[model samples]
Target: MSYTIPFPRTALLAALGVACLAAGGARADAVPAAQRPVGEVTMSVGPVTRTTAQGLPEMVRRGTPILPGDRLDTADGGHLHIRFIDGALVSIRPGSRMLVEDYKYDPQRVSASLVRFKLEYGVARAISGAAAEGARERFRLNTPLVAIGVRGTDFVVRAGELTTRAAVNQGAIVMAPFGADCTAQALGPCGSSSAKLLSADMGQLQVEFRPQLAQPEIKPLQGAVFATNSTPENGSTVVAARSVAAAPAPAAPALGRTDSERLATAALADGAVTAAISGQAAAPVPPPAVTPPPVVITPPPEPPPVVAVPEPTIPLPPPVLAWGRWAGVAAGDGDIALPRAEAADGRSVTVGNAQYNLYRASDGQTELARGLGSYQFALDKSAAQYSLAGSVSPATVEQGRLLLDFGNARFATDLRVANALTGAVGISGAGAIRGDGIFFDRSVAGQAIAGAAALDGKSAGYFFEKAVGAGTLSGITLWSRP
Candidate 1:
C-alpha cells in the first residue's frame, strides 16, 4: 500500500492566527501558510538545538517536527537528520547552523511543492526527496555568496567564512551568485545572473568570495586545501602574465634600501618639517630630474615562411546511440528473465517523471501478488540510475534481488540476496539485460552493487527505470507484484 499526506493548510493558517493574536494583531488570517512544518528530525546524536520563531532555543529529539523559520544549531559533536514529508533526507553534520527558511509539499499538486534552506555555517548533505524532484527549480539552498538548485540527487555542501564548497555525490546542481541582480556599481535589490552547472563526475567546486569582487570565483577543488586567495583576476591575467613573462631582466628588488638609509631619510624629512613649522630657513631639497624620451627605430618585417604548413585536423564528434527498441527474449533453463505479464493495477509510484511498478514473485518465476501502488524513483545523475535507498517498493526475486545498473551503452541487472534470519547476503550474478542487440563489451564482473534492501512487509517490488544506455526502458514493466 502507498499513501501521501495532503498539505495542512488549515493547521498552518491556525498557527498563523495564533501567532498574530499573540503579537496583538488581528490580521492573522491574512498571513500565508508557507511557513509551516514540512518535516521532522528522524535522527539526532549528541546535542542538537533548534531556535524557534519565538527566539527560544530547545534541544531537538528524534521525531521532533521542524518548521519554516526554525534555526538548527548542532554542537561540536552533534549530528542531525531531517526527513521532509516529501521524502528528502537532510543530514546536518557537527558544528553546523541551518535554517529551514521555507518548505511546501503537495505531491498531487505540483505547483504547491517547494523547498528552500539556508546553511549559515558547517556542512550538510541533502538527498533529493520526492518534493525536490517534483518541484524542480523551486528547490534551492542558500549560502553566503551563492544559491544552489538541485536536480534530484545527493549532494554535500560546506559553508565557511571565506568560501562555500559543493560536491555532487549524485546528479547535478546549478549554483548562481547571491544578490547578483543589482548592478555592480550599486548594491541594491537582489537579482540573479548566469549560474554554473556542476556534475558529480566532475568532482567538487569551491566558490571563493573576495573583497571588491562582483562575482565569486569558482574552481575545481583539488584537495582539502581550498584556494582562498585565487580570484578571476589572479587566475586568468596576473598569474598567467607572470608565468609567461621572462624573469624581470634580473633587476634589483624595488625599494631595496637599508634600514639606516630609511631612518636618515625620515630624520631629514622631520628636520625640514620642524624648520617649516618654526618659519626658519632649512636645507634646500634637490629638484626632480626630467625623464628622457627614447629614440624610436623601425624594424624590418619578418620574411614570409619558406614552406606552407598543412591545416590542422578537426576532431570528429563522439558516436551517439540510436536508442532503438528490442523485444524481450524468453529465458531457457538457468537463464534469467522477467515474466511476460501486464503490471498489476494500482501498484506503482511515480517520482519526478518516472513511475515504478512494484511486484512480488516466488523463486524468481512464480508471481505472487503485485503491490498496491507505485513509488517514486529519484534519479541519481552521478550513478546514472534511480536511487534505491529509502525506496517505498523494491522488487523481490527468489531469495536474492534484481538491481538496476544504468550506464552509457548498457542496462545491466544484478541478482543480490541475503538471509533474513542470519543477515548473510551477496550478489550472485550480473549481466547486461538489454543493449544495442549486441554482447555488451564492458566488463560486468567486479561491478559493485550500488544499494540493496530486504523484502519486508512494507517493501514492494516495482520501480520505474530510466534508461541511461543505448536503449529505452522508460515505462516498461521491469518488475511487478503478482
Candidate 2:
C-alpha cells in the first residue's frame, strides 16, 4: 500500500539529497595537479626521501618531480639538490627536513609567479631564480621564528629547535618574525618603521633568533662561540632595528718612494746648498754696511732652541701571500656546534670544503678574500652537505682580528694567535664563523690548525680543539685551488 510521507519528512529528505549532490560536486572540482610541479630533484645522494601530498612516502631519486606540499627528509650523509623550473636552486643538507609549501612559475607571465618554502629543520642553501628577479617581492621562506623575503639573491638558512639563522651570499634578503608579511619593500609588523636594510657587502649578513628574545639579532658573520645561559628568565619582546652602512672607499696610497726621493732632492738643491755657501762665503760685498745701525746687535733675547716635533709613524701592511683562489677544509671534533657535555652518545660528523680568492688592492694595505664552498654534516646517522658562497672584502690583517667572508657567511678570529706557513696555517682564538646556513662560535682558546698538504698544493685538515661539550665532534675539510 502506498503511503504519503509527511511534509516535514519529505522536505528533510530533499534537503539531504541536495547536500550530497553539493558535496559530490565539490569533490569533483578539486584538481590535485592544478598547482603544477615547481621543480625536480636534480641530484640525490645517500638516503634522501620525500613525502607527497597524498601521504605517500618514497625514496627520492634524481629527476623526481617535486610539487608543492612535498616534504623532503635527508638522513646522515644524505644530500639533495633541487632545480626549479624558474632556474632557482636549493641544496639540502643531511639530517634535515624541508617542505616546498608553494611554488608557481609561468615563464610568459613572470609577474604572477610565486615561491614559498618551509624549512622545518636543518640547513639549506638557495639561489634566486626567475621568480626572484621577476616577482621580486613574492618569494618567501618560513622558519620556526622568522619569514625571509627573497630579493633576487643567493642565501643560506638553518633552522634549529631553539634558534634560526640566515646568511645572505649574493644580493639581499629581508627577515621578519613568524606570521608577519615581511617583503623586500615592507618590513611588516615584525620591523619598525625605521628598520634598516640588510645587504651583502664584502661580508655576509647574519640574522639569528632566540626563544627568549622578542626579535631577531643581526650582525656580521663572525665565527665565534656563543654562550647559552640555562637559567630561565623573563623573555623580552623588544626588537632592535639595524641597517648596514656602506663601507668607505679605501684611503689613497702613500707617496711612492721614487716621488719622495725626487721631492727631497729638489728641497736640498733649492735651499740647503745655497744657504750653506752664502754663510761660508766672506761678506764679499760687505754691502755698504750701510746702517751699521749701531750695535743694535743687542742680540735679541736668545730664542729658545727650536724644538722639532716628530711626525706620526704610519704602520706598514703585513706581508701577504699570493692573491688568488685558495681552497681547503677544516675538520675536527670542534667543528660540531653542540656542547661536549651534551654529546655523551657519539654523534656523526662530516667534512667541509671552502674556496677563497684572496685579493689585494694597489694600495698594498687593502686586502680581501672572496669565498664559496660547502659544509657536510652527518647527524643521527644521516649525512648531507649544503652549498654556500660569499666574499670578505678588505680582509685586513690587523693586530687584533682576522676576518674572512664566504659570500653570505663570515669568519673572525684573533690574528695574534694565527700563524701562516707556505703550505699550512693555524689560527686559534675566541672567534666565530657565520654563513652557509650555519653559525659557529669558537671558544676563547679554541684552535683550528691544518698541517697536511697535498701534492696538489691543497690542505686537508681539522678544526676545533676546545669545543665545550662536543665530544669528539670534529670536522674534516679539504682546501683546493681550482
Candidate 3:
C-alpha cells in the first residue's frame, strides 16, 4: 500500500507556463524587436537569400525588410533591388554578395545622416537619394580595391577580390585605393593623393582600380559594364524599342495516318480491285471503228502588253562614326590610326605629354538621317551643379527637352534647373549643328552651350555653365531620342 500526496492544479499550470516562456524567449533572441529595419526589398527574383545579424537565414522576397548588419547573397541567377528609408536605390546582380555595413538617417536632422555599403563580389548600381544628397561627406560605398564617394551620382560598379571597376551614369564619383593614407574606417570618399575623379562629362570613360596599380586608370567604357541595362540572367530593367504583347497559343497539327498503316490500307484496296476485275464478265467486241473528229488549230492568246514599272528609290543610311579614347597614342599613329580620317592635318591637340596626340573629329563626316525629332532629358544620366553653403552640390533638373531639325542641322532647347537650397532658373538656347555633329555657341541667354550628337545619333550630352547670383551654376545634360 502507498500513501498519495495531493498536487495543486495551480502548480501544474505554473510548471507548463515556465516551459512555454523558455521556448518563446529563444525565438525572441533570434530576432530582436528592438532592431529597426533600414530598408525594404522592392524587387526580388530567382534565389536570393538574406542572413540576419543574428545568423538567421531567410528567403528574400518583395517587401522583405532589410535590417542593418544583414548580409545578402544572390545565387547564380538571382537579383535583388532595395530601397532604403532615405530613398536611395541599390540593385544587386547575380552571384553577388553585399552587406549594409551601417546606415543612419533622420529627416528632421539631415546633416547628421550616415550611409555606407559594402560589395563583396559581383556588380551593383547605386543611385543616390536624400541621405546621400543631404550629407555627401558622410556617405561611402566600400569595395575590395577602393572606396567610392559620390557627388549626387548614379553609378554602376563591379567589384572583385583583386580589382574594382566603376562607371558613372550621372554626376561624378571619386575613387581611392585602400592604402596607408586611405583607411577603411574613413567615411565618404577618401581624400588621398591617389584619389581619382570621374564625371559624366568625361565622354563615356570608366575607372579601374587594381592592387598593383599606383593610381586608378581611366579606360574606355566597356559594354560588359553596362550589361545591367540589358536583359540579365535574373529579372532587371530591360531596354526595348517597344512593349511586347502576349502571344496566342499555336494550333494543333493536322492528324494523319502513319506510313505503315497507309501501306496496309493500299494493299487491301489493290486486292479488292483485282478481285472485282477477275470476277467481271467478258465484254462484247466493239461494233465498228468510229470516224475521227476533225482537227482544229488556234493561235495562243496575245501576250499582255508590257508595262515598265520604275523601281522605288531607296535612300542610303548616313555614315556612323566610331568613338574611342586614346591615351599616349600619337597622331596618324599606326597602332591607333584615326578612324575615318581623310588626312591627318599633322597638327594634333596635345593634352599632357608631347608623345600623345588627339585627332579632332571635326574634319570627319557627320551627316545623319534627316528628320525633325524631340529628345527628352535622361535624369538618370543628367545632373546640375550648384553650391550648398559654399560646398559644391548636385542641383536638380526639373524638366528639359530638345527640339532638333536634323535636315537643317539646327536645335532648340527648353530646360529648367533648380536647387532646393538655391533658386531655380529657366534656360532656352538655339544652336547650329556642325559637320561633325557638334553644336556650340558662347552665349545662350548669357550661358555657354556645347555638345555633340552620339555616335548612333540617338543621344546627345553637353556641358552647361551660367553665372547665378554671386556664384556660378554648371552641369551636364544627357538627352535621349523620344
Q: Model 2 — TM-score against the truth?
A: 0.39
Q: What is the lDDT of candidate 1?
A: 0.48
Show how many residue pairs clash in every candidate, following the order shown. Answer: 26, 46, 0
Off by over 4 Å in 3: 1-34, 226-482
Estimate, for each residue in 146-241, the C-alpha lDDT of model 2 and write its tens digit: 777766677777777667777665677776654222333332123432122455663644766543222466655633211121112112123477
Q: Model 3, range 179-273, lDDT digits (tens) per residue?
A: 66576778988987568999988977888775423457786776655454333321223455787898988989998988886675443344456
Model 3 gets an lDDT of 0.66
User: Could you estimate the TM-score for every candidate?
Assistant: 0.38, 0.39, 0.43
**Model 2: residues >4 Å from true position, as ranges?**
1-35, 179-196, 202-204, 223-482
Model 2 lDDT, residue 395, Cα? 16
Off by over 4 Å in 1: 1-36, 182-194, 203-218, 222-482
Better of 2 and 3 by TM-score: 3
Q: Give per-model CA RMSD.
A: 29.2, 24.0, 22.8
